[model samples]
Target: MTELVSTTPGLYPLPDWAKQDLSDLKGHQKHDLISGDEGPEIVDVYDRAREEVVSEQVDAGLDRIVEGQLRWDDMLAHPLTVHENVETGGIVRYYDNNNFYRDPQVKGELTFSGDVAAELDATSELLDDEALQAVLPGPYTLAELATNEYYDDDAAFLDAVGEFLAGEVDAFPEHETLFLLEPSLVTDAPDEDLDERVPDAIDRIVDATDADVVVQSYWGALEEKVYAHLMDANVDALGFDFVAGDRDQTLYNINEYGTKDDIALGLVNGQNTLVESPETVHERVEWTLDRIANKSFDRAYVTTNTELFYLPENRATEKLTALAEIANIPEVKA
Candidate 1:
C-alpha cells in the first residue's frame, strides 16, 4: 500500500496576535526582540502561534505536522543569518516573489550557534503524540544567499556552509521527517561547478540523520542537469513544484529518471490568494497519482508548492484544510 501524506513545505504566516506582538517590538534589534527582557513575551507569542498551527493541522487531519516556522522572518535563510558568526545586511528580493530576506554576511568561519537547534527542541515539546517534520534551508541555498567575506574560494565557502548545516541536522533526532528547502537550485541555477557540489553537500547534510529526508525545490523547474543531480542524491524523497514549475517537464524527468524514491507532489498553490475547492484539489491529486502510478515510487506526499507565508493566515489554513480533505480520499494504489 502506498502511504499518502499531506504536509506543508514550512514557514507558515504568523497569526495576527503574533504579528502584532512582533510589530510592537519594531526597531528593537533581533537580540532585543528575541532574547532581551521582552524576549520571553515574544517566545510566548511564538508558542501560542505554534499551538494554533498544530491544532489546525490536527483538526485538518494531516498525517504530519510542522512547527509552522513563525520565527523565520527571512524565510529559509533565517537560521544562517541569525548565527553568531554571520551578520545581517541589506535586503534582497526573495526568488521571483515580492518578498525579501536580509542577506546573510559571513564574517568568520561558518559554525552552528544552537539557535536553530533550540527552536527544534521547543517544537518537539509541542508535538505531543503527533509526528513532527523538521524543516531547514538547504546548504546550497544558504550559501547562495550569503555574502562571503571569510572564505577566499566559493567552493570552500559552500563546503563550509554545508558542514554548518549538517551540524544543525544532527541536532534534530526527534523529527520523523526532515525537509531541506532548496529553492535556489531553480531560482539561481548555479552556472558553475557548484551544480555538482550541491548534491554532494545535500548528501553530507542528511548522512547522519536517521529521519527520512526530502529535498524540496520550488520557484521553478530546475535545470535539466541539476534536476538529474538531485534525483541521485542520498535522500529518501524529492519534491517538485507542480503549481509553480513546468509540470509536464517535472513529470517527464521523474518518468525518465525513474522514481526510485518517494515522491512529493506540490499540487496546492501556496502563493496565491484564491482558495481551491476540495473537488478541484482532489482532481489534481488524482492527476498526479495517475502519473506516479506508471512510475516506481514507493510513497506519495501531497503538499503545497511552497511556504504559505505569502498568503494570509486564514487563507493558508483554508488551503491546509483542503489538502487534508484530499489526503483522506481513498488511495488508488499503483
Candidate 2:
C-alpha cells in the first residue's frame, strides 16, 4: 500500500488580517516588509502573519509543514528582483492567467544573495526537520520568467540560473523535502531542444541539495516529450496537476515512460472558491492509481493543483482540511 501524505504546493493565501494590515501600510512601511530594513511594527506584522500561516498547516494535519511563503511578493520574480544584479521591469502577465508580476530583468551575473531561506529558517523554529518542507521557484521556471540581458546564450543563462538557485538551496535550513514549483513547463511549453536542455538545468539544482527534491509542475500537465525528458532528471518525485491539467495525458506519460519512486497528486482545485469533500478527493486519487496499477509507489502526496493564493483564505484552509481527511482515508492508504 502506498503511504498517503498531505502537503500543499506552497504559496499559501495570506489570512484576511494580514492582507488588511499590509494594505493599510504605505510608502517605506510597505517596502520595508520585503526589504531587510523593516521597523518593529512592520516586523511584528510579518512575524505574526508567518506564525499564523504556519499554524494553519499544522492544525490542518498536513504531514509536511511548508513555510507558507507569506513573505513572497510574487512567487517567481520575487527571488530575482530582490537580488542586486536583477532589476524589476514593467509588469508582465503571469502565464494565461489574469495575474501579473514585475518582469525580473537580469542585469548582471546571476548570484544568490538570499530568498526563501530566511523565511524557511524562521519557520524551522516552529517545526522540526521531520515535518519541514522548503519551497522555491524551479530554475527553468525562473529563467523563463526573467528577461535575460546578462548572458548572450540562452543555455548559458539557464545554467547560470540553475547554479544561482543551487547556491540558495545549499544555504537553506534543515528540511525533509524541497519542492521546486515549475508551472512554466505547462503554461509555456518549451520546444524540442529546450525540453532536453531543461532536464540538465534541473539536474544541477537537484544535485546541490541533500533534501528530497520534488519537481512539481502545475497549471496543466506537460506534453509527452517534456514529461519523458523530465523523468530522466535525478528527482525523488514528480508532481502532476490532476485538477487543472490533462489528466489522461499525465496518466499516459506515467504508464509509457514510467515515473519516479514517489508521486505528488494535485487532487484539490486551488483556483476554485468551492472546496472538495474528502470522499471526492479520495475517489479521484483511487481512480488515477487504479489506472496505473502496474506501477508501485513508496509514497503519494495530496496537493492543490496550483498555489492557494488564487483562492480566498477560508476556502484554502477548508481545501487543506479536506486533503488531510483524504490522506487518512483507509481506502486511500490501502
Candidate 3:
C-alpha cells in the first residue's frame, strides 16, 4: 500500500513572540545569536519557540515532524557563516525572492563541530524516533551558494563541504528522514560535469546515516540532465517544487527518468498568503499521482513547495493543517 504522509520540507516561520524578542536585540547581540553564543534570554526564546513549533505540527496531525528550524538565520548559508574558518561577506539575494542571506567566504578547509547536529539532538528530546525528520542544505547547493576562496578546484571544495555535512549527520540523534535541500540544481544549473561530480559528493554526505535521505529541490524543477544524474545517487527520493516550478516538466522528468520507492510532492504553495483548502490540496495531490501513475512508490510525502517562513505564522499553520488533512483523504490515501 502507498502510505501518504504530511510534513514541512524546510524551516517553519518564527512565531511573533520570538520575532519580537529578536527585534529587541542590538546588532552585535544578533551576531552572537547566529554564532550559537546567544545570551540566556535568546536561548530561552529558542527553547520555548522550538517546543511550541513542534507542538503545532503534532496538534495539526502531521505524520512526520520537522524541528521547525527556528534557529536558522538563513537556510543554505547559515552553517557556513557560523563556522570560525569562514568569513561573512555582503548579502546575496536568495534565489528570485526578496529574502537575502550573507555570503560565506571560505578561508580554509571546512570542518564541522556538529552545531546543526546538536540542534537536532535538542529537538529529538521532544519527539519520538518515528516522527522526527532532520533537515539541512545539500552539499551541492551549499558549495554553489558560498564563495570558496580555500580549495583549488570546485570538486575539492564540494568534497570538503560534503565531509563537513557528513560529520553533522554522524552526530545527529535518531531521525526517520533527512531532507537535503538542493534548490541550486534548478536555480543555477551546474556544468556538464554534474554526472561526474554530484553523485559522489552526495554519497559522502549520506554514507554515515541510515535515515531515509531525500534530495529536495525547489524554485523550479531540475533540467533533464540534472534530474537524470541526481536519480543515479543513493538517495531514497527526489523532491520537486510543484507550486513555484513548472509542474509539467517535473512530472515529465519523473515519468521519463523514473524515481525511487519514496517521493515528496510539494502540493502546498509555501510563499503564498492565500491558504489552500484541504480539498484543493487533495485535488493537486491526485493530479500529480495520476500523472506519475506508471511509477511505484511505497511512501509519498505531501509538503509545501518552499519554506514556510515567507508566509505569516497564522497562514503557515493553516497550510500545515491543510496538508495533514489532504494526506488522510480517502482518494489520496488509497
Clashes of each: 0, 0, 0
Which of 1 and 3 is the better model by lDDT?
3
Q: Candidate 2 — what's its lDDT? A: 0.82
Ordering by TM-score: 3, 2, 1
Across 1-334, the per-residue lDDT of candidate 2 in tens digits comes to 8888888888877777877777776644222344544567766778898898888888888888888876666566678877888877877887877767778889999877866688888899987434898888888899899999999877888889888888888888888888899998998878776788888888887887888899999887788899999998899999999988688888888999999999998889999998899999889888888887578788888788888888888898898899888766785542
Instruction: Choose 1 or 2, whichever is better by lDDT.
Output: 2
Order candidates by lDDT, high to low.
3, 2, 1
Worst lDDT window (10 residues) for model 3? 26-35
TM-scores vs. true structure, each candidate? 0.93, 0.94, 0.95
- Angstrom error at residue 157, model 3: 0.8
**What's model 1's TM-score?**
0.93
Highest-scoring model, lDDT: 3
- Root-mean-square deviation of each candidate, in angstroms? 2.2, 2.0, 1.8
Could you give candidate 3's per-residue lDDT for residues 94-170 as a string of tens digits? 88888777888999878776778878888888885448898888888999889999998888898898899998888
Residue 275, candidate 2: alpha-carbon lDDT: 89
Model 3 misses residue 130 by how many Å?
Answer: 5.4
